[model samples]
Target: MATPHTIAVAGKGGVGKTTTCGMIIDYLCSKKTGPVLVVDADANSNLNEVLGVEVETSLGAIREEMAQAELKGTIPSGMTKADYADFKFSSAIVEEDEFDLLVMGRTQGKGCYCYVNGVLKSQVDKYAKNYSYIVMDNEAGLEHVARGTLPHVDTMLLISDCSRRGVQAAARIAEMIGEMELKPGKMGIIINRAPNGELDSGVKAEIGKHGLELLGVLPQDEAVYRCDCDGEPSSKLPQSNPVKQALKGIMQELGL
Candidate 1:
């Protein structure tokens, strides 16, 4: 089995992580470098929208069903718990021409996030080996890492907006990753939604304070904003789109 190289994107909410994930997938697909397994690990899932797809099911929903069934002692007659889980997990993936997407939707009325996260980890551990690349779009903060949702990350791209708080959030996440010993092969920071793709000195100082490698900055592109307004898939952004081009350059810089 080929070991899949996993790229997990983390950032504060509204920091453009989902759009960046979509662009990464698009670039990979354009280069014929799939099949990638795209994981929307955010509770408030929106990667499907960015990628121009609809999620009919999610791992959270599946986990909820399994929990209910287990309570009722219902294992679908002949199937064992493990087998049934594997079956349901297969259905949760949305197959696309370039890659497959798995969404980790909200765990409703949560008793604890432990169970669902474990299930997601199990599925990713099992399914990821079949792919050459696995790109995970994580929820805000470090909960996913703490839960072991992503067993390993080849590249951890910490994204932040132009705000000081956003950079602080990324720095905190990086600290968490280190403190938890979830060391990825490479880790870097991306400043998204930068004004004219330029960073202010204060922002640079904050980044320096955390010693985060500046992967690159994504310009505030009107095309991306327009697509969001008109409900267009960001993955369909034109090849000349500045945001897309900048992300491609960043990916190249990482030797992806």
Candidate 2:
């Protein structure tokens, strides 16, 4: 199935999932790049940081207040579903060199973020229709997505590090999506920080066990770590970066 939306990356923390997504954004931004909308669904969104943009309002906050306002039946004047969605549109898209971003920050401890997530997903669907592509840096769990943040996605990239725990997290996300059976346009897996030389046959088997396609492996990039330490724009990663090259390879295989 041909999908207009390019991709979404989800996986365990510390797996370099965010960096991979940022690299994809950098690639897409550099090419013909009509407006591209990036939705940072992770509560701990540093996509803004990776890309070197300041993150402002988060979508979670907007929805929380919107729900409250709706309950009061006194929504701020000029706020209807249509108006609200528009406000969300205006609030979310952070303009940069060639890309736009919509951040959904970490949920407050109040409760599940499923409600806010649903609204975001809805708006994102509508938002994507207007752009050439949408890149979502998703939250850790696939629960929100399973609940319908994005029932149908173009491609869901499950990322994991070379650890058993990271691999387990990816497996769980895949299982969550599978249990929900929310058929996406396409979905796959990409293991990061793969060990070199001596094989951990146990770990390798665990990766192969998943039904999703294995896209590629990314060696831990010291450049990325250094950039983060200095708060640099990861999008500007030199072509010599190993992870950057691996990400490009993954994108090509996905036909982006």
Candidate 3:
């Protein structure tokens, strides 16, 4: 087994970050790059929905169950606590044709997530070598990265809408990544939902001010909007669809 290339897509909410991640996974599968491991590190945990997959459980849910079961001494008679946890963790991964989805669900009535996070990190480390690429859709902020919930990123794609505030938020995340010394091989910003696939001059200026690499701009496509409205996976968008095409081009530019 070889090390996998990990790509992390991050942005503020409502910026189409998850949708972009779905498309990236679709593109990699379409190209027959290799098996992809998709981790939804977002607490909102809608990556499965965007990918048209049903998730029966999440790591957080499993963690909570393990904690309760331990308190109640409900571990199976033969299996040790570690074995039971491994069983539950394996069950949380939703396997798909092209990729496997692991969602980090929200904690409920939690004391802290430190234990579960360790479990997730170990699982991810164990499973990572089997895939050629690992793509993660992260939470709005850097909580996942700061907490070391996921693997080191190879490429970091920061997403932003055509707004100054969105860019500013992305810039702050980029800054935090630098301060944390993640040192991703490639880091850039994708301006999504740009009208007519064009960036506002002010937005360009903002990007310049922050010194963020402009990876590409994705147009606001009606097809994508309609797919979301219909609860269809954006990956189902046709290749000729503007959003899909634009993203494909960007990925090509990145040599993915």
* Superposed Cα deviation of residue 254, candidate 2 (Å): 1.6
TM-score of each: 0.96, 0.85, 0.96
To one decimal, what is the Cα RMSD in angstroms of model 2 from the true structure? 3.0
Q: Against the hidden true structure, what lDDT does model 3 obtain?
A: 0.89
Among these predictions, the greatest TM-score belongs to 3
What would the per-residue lDDT of candidate 3 be over residues 1-256, giving only the tens digit for each residue?
6999999987888998999999999999999979999988887789887789999889989888988999999989899988998898999888888899888886688447666667777888988999999999988875867776657789999999999999999999898888775778889999999999999999999999999999999999998898889999888777898998999999999999
List ranges where model 2 is wrong by over 4 Å. Answer: 1-3, 64-85, 106-109, 195-202
Across 150-240, the per-residue lDDT of candidate 2 in tens digits comes to 6357788888887767777888888787777566678777877765412256766777775557777777667777888898987789866
RMSD of each: 1.3, 3.0, 1.2
Taking the candidates one at a time, how many backbone clashes does each contain?
0, 2, 0
Off by over 4 Å in 3: none
Pick out the ten consecutive residues of candidate 3 with the lowest summed lDDT. 110-119
RMSD of 1: 1.3
- Which residue pairs overlap in candidate 3's backbone? none
lDDT rank order: 1, 3, 2
lDDT of 2: 0.75
In the range 1-256, model 1's lDDT, one tens digit per residue, is: 7898899998888899999999999998888975899998888899999899988999999888987899999878999999988898899999988999999887889357777788888889989888989999988865879866677999999999987888999999898898875789999999999999998889989999889999999999999999899999988989899999999999999998
